[model samples]
Target: MSRHLLIETQGPWAGRECASFVRDAAALAGGGHRTQLLLLQEGVLGAVPGVLPELDGYLAADGDLLVDRYSVAQRGLKQEQLVAGSRLVDMDEIAGNVLDAAVKVVWH
Candidate 1:
């Protein structure tokens, strides 16, 4: 059966861990699992344009890339400044919908 994977990232995207998460999310999506990469805290930096190329492949694999709305506002980033496929989602959506619907959730 296909599984829903939700990955919650909470640190700066410039780190090795963030890069690894992108690669892993791509792998999971390519393997036929539905993947969602949710950026929170400093992780919202990953949604910024030109910051990380690793996200391109993940997005190509049909990953649902999202940034926390609160995080974006906190960092003074506009919704339009995020990467092309990334969307701004509220915490309620993350906690009440995404997390509850995912077969597995990982924090990176």
Candidate 2:
């Protein structure tokens, strides 16, 4: 199966676009693709509950969630504050995903 990596650079305040992105990611996962939603920059804010409930739906759809370790720590977000099923990953891992030929990357 192909892998889809969706990078979210915007926070929840960025509006419907962010939610729509999560929805699209979920759809990809539900369709049997390997989908991953990466939260970077202010997008790390979405790791918290209620910040982006759509994230929960994405997880339910079998999509993986990744929060940039640097972004979360820089924003003072603790591991416990993140949504369940979300993983904190190094920037290098993110770069690897983007550079991988087998993975499709989408940044917004």
Candidate 3:
């Protein structure tokens, strides 16, 4: 069975929390569980390429991750500004992914 992890990043606290989750999740991927990260609100800032430390490690894994378009727009991010592999998905997709995951980690 494939396991899924959902990370809900929504506020100031999420800046550090989401990054840690990405790092930890990437490390854990070798064990077989799939990880997905969702960034909403201020958390969208983390989606910006090159801003976070050791981002290459997380990107190398290519896990399923989504950033809220509404949130990104509110924060002044366009699709062109995103990290090379990041996707700007709709809210419905984000919510549904969260519901489908085995673990939902929320950083608020």
Candidate 4:
């Protein structure tokens, strides 16, 4: 059975678990686990290309990742700034996906 992992990262890496969450999720995806990263607020910073090489690596591998478009825009990140394979998702859809998933990991 495929398990779902929803990683909600908020804080910046130097302050909290954001880095760890991104690294772990990337590792999980590399290991063939079903994982997705949802970026909100400062969390979207992790999705910035070239800024986070670990996340960039996972994205290069086609990781299932989502960044709230509102967040991205609010954070001043353009669509081209997002990591590859990452999609823009609405808050309601994010909530629904979390509710429907087997596991939800929030790194706040």
Better of 2 and 4 by TM-score: 2
- Model 3, 5-97: lDDT tens digits are 555555334356656666776765545566666667777777777666444676677666577899899877798887777778897876676
Worst 10 residues of 3 by lDDT: 6-15
Task: Output the worst ten-in-a-row residue range by lDDT, candidate 4.
Answer: 1-10
> What TM-score fits each model?
0.87, 0.97, 0.77, 0.79
Ranking by lDDT: 2, 1, 4, 3
Alpha-carbon lDDT, every model? 0.79, 0.93, 0.66, 0.71
lDDT of 2 by residue, 1-108 (tens): 899999999978988899999999999999999999999999999889888998877999999999999999999889899998999999899999999999999999
Taking all chains together, the TM-score of candidate 4 against the true structure is: 0.79
TM-score: model 2 vs. ground truth: 0.97
lDDT of 1 by residue, 1-108 (tens): 455545555555356878888888899988878777888888888888788778899999988898899988998999889999998888787876544754677776
What value does the lDDT take at residue 34 in candidate 3?
A: 66
Best by TM-score: 2
Ranking of all candidate structures by their TM-score, best first: 2, 1, 4, 3
Assess the local accuracy of residue 84 in candidate 3 as a C-alpha lDDT between 0 and 100.
73
**Which residue pairs does candidate 4 place in steric collision?**
none
Select the stronger candidate by lDDT from 1 and 3.
1
